[model samples]
Target chain A: MVKTNKQKAGNIITALLLIILGAFMFLPIYLTIVMSLKPQEELFIFPPKLYTLRPTLDNFSSMFDILDNNRVPFSRYLFNSIAVTFTVTFSQCVFVSMGAFVLAKCRFPFSKLINSVIVTSLLYQSNVIYIMQYAVMSKMGIIDNPLALILPSIASPMGLFLMKQSISQMPDSIIESAKIDGAGLFRICWQIVIPNQKPALMTLIIFAFQASWNMQGGSLVFQEQYKTLPTVITQISTTGIARAGETMAASVFMLIPPVIVFMLTQSQVIDTMAHSGIKR
Target chain B: MDKLKKLWCDVRKNRDCYLMLAPFMILFVIFTIVPVIMSLPVGFTNFNMAQPPEFVGFDNYINLFLSDKVFTKAIRVTIIFAVITGPVSYMICFLLAWLIDGLPKKLRSIFTLIFYIPSMANVYTVWKIIFSGDMNGWLNSTLIEWGFIQSPVQWLTDSRYVLGVTITVQLWLSLGAGFLALSAGFRNIDRNLYEVAYIEGMDSKLQELVYIVIPSMKPQMLFAGVMQIVSSFTAGTVAQELVGFPSTDYKAHTIMTHAYDYGWVRWEMGYASAICTVLFIAMYVCNKVISRLFKE
Candidate 1:
């Protein structure tokens, strides 16, 4: 395990490169935190500052103040965000898991067509269909409702694709044994197969939570009370340059929960992402 | 009648699978499938929200390729964006993931989080502070201080810098899920394979990568390629977020932005659907081609 001096130098070079690249990646997210804490005087400095000589929490208080002063209280926005986020994430895990199990194991008519459709859907940008989607959402009577933010996100192709890739990696023997034991399809999907796919489930949970946490019913759901925190935060952000500090504070506010969720489950997510691709 | 009976029996035999799939399928159809399918028919029509969709045949698409100046400019900007950022960011993701893999676990996780946070945190808008035109903006002031420019560059507003600035920001957010997949792909490789390859006569790390790592990580690479291609082709949000929509002179206009400009801003749903359809087809074809290349 002893490294030669030449080998040590190469290793040092590699470490140096990683640090430089890692810093580039980390800069904006770090600046979000750093800039949020800057005092008002620092905001207008000629050649704006990257670091604050005088740090303060006044920006956050003002952000909170703005939230407090809104026609919709901050708590209502927060509540909508939390309720929608939790419902979408939980339901996605359940529904995508169920569908992914059949997609992985069962050979029904049109299964191949369904699988191809789902794969192509993964590559689709939801923006492409937004105009039509608004119409569809209205037709479903979910427009201007909390369901606008929650329902469509509950079963993404990405979630189904992730779970299907993981589930198919499970041996058929295990499912076969469960089937022979007279376990119903639902039991096998939920009780038996799913428990063993923690990494994949965690991956779905992280993505779903991240997407839902940041979901804004922007133009889709017109009601103020039903909109998520991000929609409200963007409204706060429009106060212009004099209020940039509060905007930064609001950005930090919206970012915190997802970052926390990501950190908590990242190991599982990292493990699962590696294995999420085609069977080939 | 015999074939119908056999099909019925088969359907009954696997009804549990149907039952398992129906809930997700219903939601998926309502939310994802139906909308996308509906857009295809809309692409051929002249429909606004106010009126009935009049069948327009190929007029919308004909206008896009033959008449729309902004659409052509959008295609140009998008291709420039895809060509530069797509491969460059893919290599950076791989290289960063490879180096981070070399670090200890604690540092590894921290580095991953650091690189991964921007995409998650909606950091595109945060870049506005840096690209802001005033002397108070970070990039502007820094360039002034360094004597690179006499005046604060309108980084976001200027036509000169919009594409570059947007490309830079898109690259920042590009690590995303694909990077994580590659990093974990590195971890899952059996270390013993490396030792065996080394002892069997591999001397350089590059050799080890070609011989040992890549052969074991095909699936992850394919996934990363598909993700990188999709993100690059669909990279309108970063530009629209960083620069204003219908960016100055349409310099930063992209297919996605063009679609957004028409669909949302003007409510010209018909033409917008055509633009969206074109972009989606381009993305899907690019994905299929990249996946094919990755397989090879």
Candidate 2:
């Protein structure tokens, strides 16, 4: 009877601890949502309304109206973001997979040198070369183009590394068997390796999608059209202080694409994490 | 003759694979590889976009390290921001992961989604509203209502608080990625280890964390640390916007902002590249130290 009581006490303590930690983890989000929905006048009410306030969509409406008058149409920014993100994501996957395949399966001269260069590029971020890149882009006259953003990101080191690691895990006997059957390298990759790497591929897709979507600095430097959602939203916040509600609304809108992508890809991403023993 | 023929056959057989790989290789050379190589030359030249290049040798580097007060201040600020935010954020993520690790799987997923939602949502926009300088701003309104302060504090404008505010936003956004990564790490640990500890009378929370959790999560922690360091060095955008350009008397300025200011705004490409080179060296050294410390 005494042991049972002790066990019950331990369980209660655990429950309480979890609740407190969870609340702390979630407080910032809860605060942001509440702030977003609160009426502008009552937003600063004393003791602050934790609950018990009428919500309004005035913020959302005002944001759209403001976007209508801007020189850079907000919708265009969204389109540009979608275009850049999708292009980078899809391109990175194809290239990384192919490169990984080459490095994994093929015996080629200078492979070690090429792999080292790729790793070096991966470890050193673009911030290291932003100034040089700016000069090059200026000289090339492509400073404000979408290609500037998409092209640089196509050879992602992380994607290549992950894909190589995944591909290396495939059973070599299968490839040997395929070779015996007179199937060429390309046929083996398409028919066997690619099909087997579905989980890793999905993980790469989600990762690439998220990274490209949330990219801030590249978009900042690459486009003058306010042609990306992050750039547009950043501009709004920086320039439109008086229209606080509109800024929040715009931010809310900017967040939807990434959130949807995350939700859609969460399971696959988690599965990849499990298989590879890689943390985020 | 036989060796040459074998090589020929190999090339012919792999031609299709090479074709498949061509686009990436071409783009990589043009974009990533070329820029990295070209960055070194820009550090010695005085060409703005409007003018012809004039080689200036080590003058840019000399001026940055010697005469530029703002550059020095930015380096200091970047270090401060990185030190303050990186560990605190890592701890928050670990805590969240530990808290949610034991919950029912369905509930855990829901909670993960909820916590991650804010990070996915328009971060800059939400932060703009929350940290608005006006009394109408969310933070200001809350503080006033709570009677914590008689008047609204200029959270973003004041040099004292600007870095703090930036760090706060960083902590919030970083929670999801790091937390998710660590949680995945936590889930993969051998459960039998924990069970064994429980049987061996290691019942204290600290004991479990030290012996089981931390040891198992070494790799994840190292990765998170490296990522946080790199990001802290790179992440000056939100702070620049919130704190105002030149960083409120250069108090919140970071190495990234200094490079941007020189390269883009002032059109001093040479100086900017020199500054970037220094920052790169710093990051490289820091990463080396971290790797050595975490080496198995």
Candidate 3:
């Protein structure tokens, strides 16, 4: 690709603009890290210095110190977060892929109906269903249980939709060939379908992980033992003025898993989507 | 009888699919479908947590519209938010995604991460501290130091500034999945078309975007549009997180926050469900209108 001088200048300007834009987008996160590193005394200082003159890990230590005193230790919350998020993401990716496989590859009665139901559910806000969800959870005897969080998230409409969209794009002959080879439905899904739908699966994993990771145990799993890191962070955040650094540290800690998951899987996610035929 | 026979035959033929779908469907029906349907009936009743619900048919809806002043304010605030943030974020997402698409892959991914971190990290609490009401808060301190204000302005607390501040933060976090979707859209555009268009002397970038990029990526554009509308309409968390649950004097009260207040805080589940149903209908209608725009 050859570029004229004007085009080169335009590219440089765009690059500079993007870098500045990136910094602006990231300023809050930068402040969070810097704030978490500041000493408690420095945290409350006037004009709220963006960068600390004297950095310390006291906030991190203090957050752990406080957690050490609780019946459910900090690691328990981390474990809860990890367990819930991983289970939800893994199960969701599997179930949605299965559902997507069925919808995409197999013709069945009510398949279109089921797909519409799922898409319609997406259009409606979840807040509308809060009371009933509570009632349902109570009836299911899962209130204050981690299952309350895990169950609802595992069959997310978005996950199902993404998988279905991706799966529908796959050539039908792959599944037909497997079927002719006397492959069972489950065998075909495991070997042929899931392997090909990696991009959508990755997308589902990211979304599901994020939703579970950020589950504020407000009504469903608010019990101390069942609560995830974000629940604890929200509780601490209300008292944010007094313990700003601790809250910031907790927020950053709570955020690490999703960011890590995203960084690791994002390239595969993009690459697969590139090949998934955007249009027929 | 005929339809049932046909359905049975179809079910038998696709029994394996039914088996595959059962796990997700059972959970989905129990959690998503049942709860949403239950809300429809529950919205007609007075169901405080203490007592069994008493059916009161449309009273909650009427009261919400005619009697609740704050509900009216919430609707206005929500519209103001959706009208501004929805389109702005959609356009910004497209523009940034387009620009990032032009970059090298390594740089593109890094840029994507930077733009995406706020929403991914759930960093609203960090913003809460930055916009803290105290004089020592970052925004307040910076403004005072610059002599922009004689006194510290309460970014979160003061009613006048609350809406503006919330909107700003919402816009910050808005470049999320929709941005990624659009970026993927740009990445997936066929390079052959671009080469062909260039060979034909269709050299202007903006023209290329209009003729080649958007038209080719209609599905992605529609997907991103739906995402933006859903997100914008349901944007209660930023206000609830940054500003208090019910911000000072209801300045930043959005319908979702109102639903949250009634659903959780007051435990007036029926009334809250009514509020939510209204929001659902509004979103559904908007979605329909938006979907119409994309129809061939």
Candidate 4:
């Protein structure tokens, strides 16, 4: 009876602790949702009300109106974001899987060197190279074009590493048997490799998509037509404190897609990480 | 002639593999490798996108080290932020993952999402709202209602509090990939090992964790450690994003912000590159130490 009581007390303590941590973690998100729904007058109130009895979509509607009035419509930025994200994600998945397959399956001269180089590149600070990236992008005339974002993202070494880790875990006999059947490298990659790597591929898609979505474009794509959704959100939000409501709404919109992608792929991602375990 | 023929034969034998790797290597070399190489030389030049670069050897590095007061402050702030956030968040991730590991799958995933959402929803506006300096701000409003304070505190602006506030936000956001990795690490631990440890008189959960769990999760821990270090060092943006750029008297200035100030704002490419080089070296050295510590 005493042991049962102790266990019950422990369970309650654990539950209480988790609930508190969860609430703390969810605070900013909760605030964002409430602030977005707030009417303008309620936004500036002292000892602010956490919830409003009368909520409105006025902020979002106004933000959309403002975006619609810009030289490049708000829809263009959204479309650009979706297009750039999908293009980069799809292309990177294909290229990374191919490169990863070569590294994982084939025995070749200088393969170790190549693998180490790819790994080391993960540690290299890309912020340091943003200037050069811009310089090259300008020289190549890809500036002010969405391809500037897509093309650079295709070279993502992390994607290649992730795919490489996934592919290396495959049994050697599968490839050997495929080779016995006279299946070419492309055939094996498409028919066997990619089909089996769905989890890694899903994780890669979420990562690439989120990264492309968050891309700032820096000085590369300066044209209003080419700017992505995040660029537009930051620009509008940074204007002033008066449009705090609209900024909250914009943040909510920006937050949705990644959350949706995560919800869809999180189980697969967790599975991949479990197996991968940060192993080289 | 013989060597050339041998090389050609080797290449021909691996034609399919080379063919598969072609597209990625081409883009990687052009966009990644070349750009990194180009950035190095820019450290030695005085180029402001408006004019051609002039070779100026070590002046940027010298000025940054000797005369830049803000640069020193940036270093101090960055180190403080890194030292606090890196280990605290890492331990938090590990501990929470341990606690949550025994929960039912549905509940576990829900908790994970709740914890992970902060990182995903890292919008500047949300933080701005939460840490706003007015009485209407969430923190201030709560504090006032509770009578903890008589007036609103400048959480974001006041240098005394900015670093702490930024660190808190950073710790919230720091439950990122490392957290996910550690959670998965805990889940993947062999259940039988715990049973065996228990039978062998591992009396406390602490003993089990120290003896079996941590040792077994070394790779994940190392990966998480290196990642935490890397993430913390580059986390200059959070302060800038949250507290407004160049936060009051440069209190929240970090190495990354310092670099950004020079590189983007001041248009001093050479000096900025030097700052970045220092940051890169710092990250590299820390990574080396972590890898060594985790070496079996």
Candidate 5:
């Protein structure tokens, strides 16, 4: 009876700790939801209420109205985000996985040099190269096109390194057996290695989706039609505090897709990290 | 000559491997590799977008060091930002992930989703409302109601409190991919190691973590370390978003924002390239130092 009480006490303490941490983690999100649902009158109330007695959909509707009133319709920005995100994610999955397989399994002259370059590139953020990249893009005649976005993200060094780390764990003997059975290297990569890396692919999808979804043209693509959802949201929100409720609602809209993708695939992603080992 | 011939033959033998690599490598070289290579020469010149680049050889670099007070301030701010956010966020990530490790799987995923949402969602615009400068802002209104302050505090605009607010939001958003990797690292530990640890007279969870968990988690930890260091160093976008660009008196100016100011806004492509080159070198050096620390 005493031992049972001790166990119960421990469980309660753990629950309390988790709730506190969870509250901290969830605070900003909770504030966002409440602020979005608030009407303009309630939004400015002194000692701002955490719980609202009167909630409304006016903010979301106004957000739509504000977006719809723009010269380019709201759907264009939405389409650009979705299309770019899908292209980047799909291409990264296909091209990066293949590159990772070759880098991991096949040995050729200067392979060590190549591998080190890829690893070093992991530390190279895009900020350092943004100007030079614009030059290259202009030279390539892709400055105003969506290709400027899709083409650069295809060779994600982090993705390649991550996929390589996971692929490296494949036993050499399995590849040897496949080689003995006359499987081509391409066949071996697509069939043997790629099929088993679903978890890693899902994780990459989450990352690539977030990044590509958030890709603002910001002088890269000047075409109004090609502008992404984030650029539009920022443009609208920065107008003033008058549209504060609508701004929150729009951000909530922006937040939904990635959250859905993460919810669906997080368990698998955790599993991949377990297997990938990500170490030296 | 014989060894060279053998190497050529081996290269030919791996022709299929080269074929598989060609598509991605072509794009990688064109986009990433060439830009990086060009930044070096470009940094030496005085290039405006319209005029051809005139080689001014070290003038920009010298100006940045000797005359540019903002650049120096940028360096100081970036260092402080990195020093504070990098290790603190890193420890928070590890601690939270460690604590959340053994929860029921459904509950675990829910908590993970809650924590991970901010970084993934790009919901920073919401912070603008919360920290709005006037009485209507949530924080100010609440504080005023509670008799904390008589008037509104300009959280975003005020120079004194700007960096602190940025840091707070940064900490909120900092539990990113590194957090995910660390949490997954805990789950992947061999269960038998703990049994052996206890049998070998490890009396507490703390000892087991030190002797068994951390050593085995070196790889994930290294990856997370590289990630945290990289993110902390380039943390510009958040500050730019929360506070306006060329923020009040340039209070939240960072190395990245400095690069942006010169490169994009000022149209000083060459000068901007120089700034970026400096930042690149600093990051490379820091990464080397970090990897060496992680070396077993």
Candidate 6:
């Protein structure tokens, strides 16, 4: 009876600790949602209300109005973000997978050098090459193009590394048998390797999508006309009239696509991370 | 006929793979490699975007190191931020992971999702609201209502508090991937090791954790540490925004923002490149030392 009581006390303590931590994690999100619903007057009310007294869509409507008046087409920015994200994600998966396959299966000369370079690049952040990236983009006259953002970010050494790790785990005899059957590198990679790499591909897709979607610096560089959603949302929230609710609304909108992508690919991402020991 | 057949087979076999890879390589060279190389030469010039670059070899690097006060402050700030936040955040994440490891699977997943949502949410905007200078600010209002403070604190504008706020946010936003990775590591531990320890009458806590947990989580911990270091070094955006430009007497300016100021706003490409090179070397050396120490 005493032991059971001790166990019960321990369980309660554990539950309380988790609940507190969980609240800390959820506070910002909850506040944002509440702020988005509250009117401007209610926003600044002393002793800050936890829930909206009167929920309204005025904040959402005003955000749109502001966008319209400023000649900043929010839809265009959203579309550009979506387009760039999908294009970059899709391309990165294909390229990274191919490179991974080649490195894993193909016995090419200078493979070690290539692998080293890829690893170095993976560890290196864009800030290291910021000056060069800007200069080259200017020289190429692609400063304001979406390609400037999409093209550079797609050369993902991390993706290649993940693919290599995934592909290396495959039975070597399978590739050897394919080679014996007169399967060339390309045929073997496509027919045998890619189909077998569904988990890695899905993980890559999630990572690529998240990276592209959350990309702030790269998108900030080029394409003034074709502003990505993050830039647009940031600009709106920071520079414009200080409507807290509208800013929250914009943030909420900006967050939805990645959340959807995360939900769709969550299981795959978790599974891949478990098996392959890759973290994004 | 043999040559024709060989060519046909090659085309049939390698085309898809090449096509799949072409986009990445082409894009990488154009955006990444070319730009990196291009930036190197800029370090030798004094060219603003409006004017042609005039060669002034080593001048930028010399000025940055010897004369640029902002550059020095940036380096200091970045190092300090990284030094403080990197280890603390890692510990917090690991602790969270450890705590969650004790939960039931279904409850653990729910908690994990909740913990990770803050990271996924629009961080910049949320922070802006939380730290809003107005009395309506959630943090300020709450504190005032609770009588914790007599007056509102200028959390964002005050230079002393800015870095702290930035680090706190960093800790909050940094919980997801590292925690998830460690949790996964915990889940994958060999149950037999713990069983053996228990049979040997080893204490439950030490048996389950020190013996079974830490050893199994070495790889995950290493990966998380390396990633945290890289991110902490590069991540000054929150600080940049919160502290405002010029960094409130240059206290909050990190190497990244300084590089941006020189490269973009001032168009001093050479100077920016020099700073970037310094940052890269510093980060590389740090990564090397950490990796050697951990030896993962």
Question: Which regions in candidate 2 have their CA more than 4 angstroms from the true location?
Answer: A1-28, A35-52, A66-83, A97-116, A122-149, A161-203, A214-241, A269-280, B1-23, B98-102, B128-137, B176-222
Better of 3 and 4 by lDDT: 3
Off by over 4 Å in 1: A4-7, A126-128, A168-196, A267-280, B1-4, B184-204
TM-score of the second chain for every model? 0.91, 0.84, 0.93, 0.90, 0.93, 0.83
TM-score of each: 0.90, 0.76, 0.91, 0.87, 0.89, 0.79
Total clashing pairs in model 2: 2
The docking quality of candidate 6, as DockQ, is 0.34
What pairs collide in candidate 5? A279-B219
DockQ rank, highest first?
Answer: 3, 1, 5, 4, 6, 2
lDDT of 6 by residue, B70-122 (tens): 78888888988898888888887787777776776567767767776776676
Task: List TM-score (chain A only) for every prediction.
Answer: 0.87, 0.77, 0.87, 0.84, 0.86, 0.79
Q: By DockQ, who's the top model here?
A: 3
Per-residue lDDT over B213-294 for candidate 2, one digit per residue giving the tens place of the 0 to 100 score = 8876775665556666667777688677667787677777888888888877888877777887888778778777876786
DockQ values per model = 0.49, 0.32, 0.56, 0.43, 0.47, 0.34
lDDT for model 3 comes to 0.82
Give all candidates' CA lDDT scores: 0.81, 0.70, 0.82, 0.79, 0.80, 0.71
lDDT of 3 at B18: 94
Q: Return the TM-score for chain B, candidate 2.
A: 0.84
Residue lDDT tens for model 1, A172-266: 88888889999999998888788767656766787899899988779877777888888878766763567777887888888889878877876
How do the residues B154-252 of candidate 4 rate in per-residue lDDT, one tens digit apiece? 899998999898898889888876676666566556566776776886666678789978876775676568668878888977888889898988888
Q: Whose lDDT is higher: candidate 1's or candidate 3's?
A: 3
**Residue A137 error, candidate 4, Å:** 1.8
lDDT, residue A99, candidate 3? 88
Candidates by lDDT, descending order? 3, 1, 5, 4, 6, 2
Model 1: how far residue B156 lies from native, Å? 2.4
lDDT of 5 at B181: 69
Q: Retained native contacts per candidate, as fractions?
A: 0.55, 0.33, 0.65, 0.47, 0.52, 0.41
**A31 Cα displacement, candidate 4 (Å):** 0.1
Tell me the docking grade of candidate 6: acceptable
Residues B159-193 of candidate 3: C-alpha lDDT, one tens digit per residue: 89999999999999999877876675665566677
